[model samples]
Target: MSELSIFSYLPADDPEVLEQLQDRIELVRHKLKFVELVPTVACISSLSPLKLAGGLVPELIRLAGGTPVELEDLAAADPQYIIVALEGSPLNTAMSEVETLMALPGWESLDAVKNGRIYLADGEGHFSDSPAGIVETIEMIGEILNPKQFAFGYEGEGWIKFGV
Candidate 1:
């Protein structure tokens, strides 16, 4: 048992923590009330290799109030939202990646692509492999999914629109 485990770090047994968590949950729920329905989201890590969602990626999408689905599902039915995660900063490369993905067959048919719901995630210290990146990632995803509620720019915050 590592002392640094999430089980030990979480304040699961603390009533105050629970109350605070509940409050935040309620706030998020209230903010999303006008959303009507959550969209199905697909996360793509790469275009050439065709890497798809797994691990924290799906969890982040869920926290953002979108249903995470596999890339294969995109072929069967298009997802309403798409998140493309880049390796690092220098948005030129990220934009190129998005262009490459859009060039793929059937990609243009996706509702997300047509509706401008496609996004790119890349920034220094914004998206990290460490667990500490979860909060920022969730926030970024929330802003992307519901800009009306989480209104914020993504340019310097590790996220950005594919062309905008």
Candidate 2:
């Protein structure tokens, strides 16, 4: 199994918090261990179980072009894309929150993950102030996924294609 990079901001010092975290981690590890090959797209998010299980989860199934193991079930889980789905303001607005998640044990230690591909999936459309905002968002994901494949520019009217 490759390194597991977890995205979370749950405090680690508290006993109750630690126990819960350990339990969740164990579950995730167990699940990830079942997968056998690299998945096309892995939707990594901290969304509520209901929202993730009901919505994003299914979309990811289709996006992956093959079966995708839950974040917990990934065995060789050196994540290629760390997709962050946030509501309200852009994820950049919550820099501290992002940093906290990055500081989590698994994420902080993963040296292989290239930086800045950190995605800010803003469904609230808060960045509509800039007509090219969607393109910028897509560019960020592209950069994080593969800098060589995507050019950093707005393709008129927020059209974007990240080398997925």
Candidate 3:
């Protein structure tokens, strides 16, 4: 995967940049050691309940020391954190989906919903099918799962807190 390629590159082919990247990676690793072992899920329900599986999203969740919950297990898993990707921006299509999910039967009983951990992500640059997008998605997931350890300042870039 191209996102995984970041590990193979030398950080812009510059010694200084490479060193900085390595340092940042090490810091993230150190912080991941303290990440709470919580169940997490990422889904793109633009058409159907298509959950992220065997891709960068799951890898990112694992890197953040979170338990990646599969779609089949979501109903029974009661995930603590949920990353929802929509076909458009949060203000438009995404917000509608969030509201639809919120209206589902017993949806409010989920841990993610009850605790306000349902994050809304964009489908374009934020959750694209490219490697760079995956990297950004990982960074965002890291910030969401362990803000103290992985504060990459993803306020309005890849995702935002889900709100009514």
Candidate 4:
């Protein structure tokens, strides 16, 4: 199989740092040449289920340049890799989304095992002290799923883009 590339379209970050990271991330994109982009963003707290149904999810899929997996199919397929990007710290708010992801039957038992990974991108300045630690934790989760040495990656401030 080819190297799966998933892109997380997170929200606004610290304006000052975001400028630089945007350039770097674009460079990385060029280097990686990711084709299978699964674009995603952190869902804010203000959304209602009805509103999400209307256009929110669709927008994310559009941004990713791909289609969003149906909740039913997601559970049934049990993909080997998944990446989720957040606007803020995962501990603070992203966890809620994680809960939602976990609640899905497709993902409930599905886990990203070795070589499979998760990433944090386009986040605000609310991250913890050890960003590497966080990435490790995510990788560990992948290991749990696949029992292989999955590696987690993070792009600190470079992911945030202008006007986002």
Candidate 5:
């Protein structure tokens, strides 16, 4: 859809930029092909009311080699990777909120927390709905979920490992 939108509005004379975007998207897709059979991932975008991430966020997690835990069945799901990407929150602010989740019942026993797979990501900045942000967000997730396979240099800026 982002590609289609670009093609629809890009200047007719700037095929070069359009081609570049297409190439980038294709590369990301190809990388996604190598990611499969991953562990369950829990992506939370809020803490005050315990909101789960929705929209393309879950899709992106799947593409980045994660088995997204169904939001409706989260109580029964055992997540291996937990991502806290609070809407409108940067990395620092999101990091500060991890404690709230830790304090929740059964939080410390979760596989994600026990294995140190919790992460704080900059949702408002790099996890936006923009085409570029989506691509980068996928790469960042890939790096987080499958660190042995990917490293797009998004660490410390786009996301951070959280250990309680």
Candidate 6:
């Protein structure tokens, strides 16, 4: 669990709010536990230099029924879905960044690209490190990864999926 990160952003003295958020997150996790398809997913935190995410993001992916693609093995990982959420970037800016990422040499070679399973998230609110945002991010990714099984109404605002 990323309780440390979520709790740090919240009030240190207010344990009640933290406890409630934790319980909510656990409920979401339990629901995702029976998910049928655990797809490979890669989360990109940067665009200019092509920096992939690590640390807490991957744990959230696992909880949302996905296997986080290894940062060092992007090509071989063949991730089924890719989420790009540059920090401080809104949905529009993230869309532009997705265009930049698509221009990379082997971008189309990935399974995600070929299948049009790529997604762009709003960084400011959707993928932030705050307690409530963290829980929403899980639902956002869960809806993207398992459309048939889960939908927390984060489709248009929090994230937008690109379909080819």
User: What TM-score, computed on C-alpha atoms, does each candidate reach?
Assistant: 0.72, 0.39, 0.72, 0.32, 0.82, 0.85
lDDT (10s digit) by residue, model 1, range 49-140: 66665655675676668888775546665888887775445455667665578676687778887888878776334444443354456667
**lDDT string, candidate 6, 1-164, tens digits:** 45456546554577898777777667767887777778899898788777777656777787678888876455777789999887767888888765688776578799999898999898878677677877788788888988877778988898998764
- Report the Cα RMSD per candidate: 5.1, 16.4, 3.8, 11.4, 3.4, 2.4
Runs of candidate 4 with Cα error greater than 4 angstroms are: 1-26, 33-72, 86-91, 108-164
Candidate 6: RMSD to truth: 2.4
The candidate maximizing TM-score is: 6
Clash list (residue pairs), candidate 6 = none
Off by over 4 Å in 5: 1-19, 32-36, 72-75
Pairs with steric clashes in candidate 4: 21-158, 75-106, 112-142, 113-146, 114-148, 114-150
Stretches of model 2 off by over 4 angstroms after superposition: 1-42, 47-54, 57-69, 73-76, 111-117, 121-123, 126-164
After superposing candidate 6 on the true structure, give the runs of residues whose Cα lies further than 4 Å from its correct spot: 1-12
Residue pairs in clash, model 5: none
Per-residue error for 15 in candidate 2, Å, reads 56
Q: In model 1, what are the clashing residue pairs, if there are any?
A: none
How does each model score on lDDT?
0.65, 0.38, 0.63, 0.33, 0.75, 0.78
Global fold similarity of model 6 (TM-score): 0.85
The candidate that wins on lDDT is 6
lDDT (10s digit) by residue, model 2, range 9-86: 234457685466555434433443454443344444444331222233323233222233354432245444444444
Q: Give per-residue CA lDDT, model 5, range 1-164, as digits (tens).
A: 23354334333466786576556556666776776657889888888887778777777776677777866334467688888898878888897776787776678678887889888999788766766676777788888987767778999999999867
The candidate 5 region of ten consecutive residues with least summed lDDT is 1-10
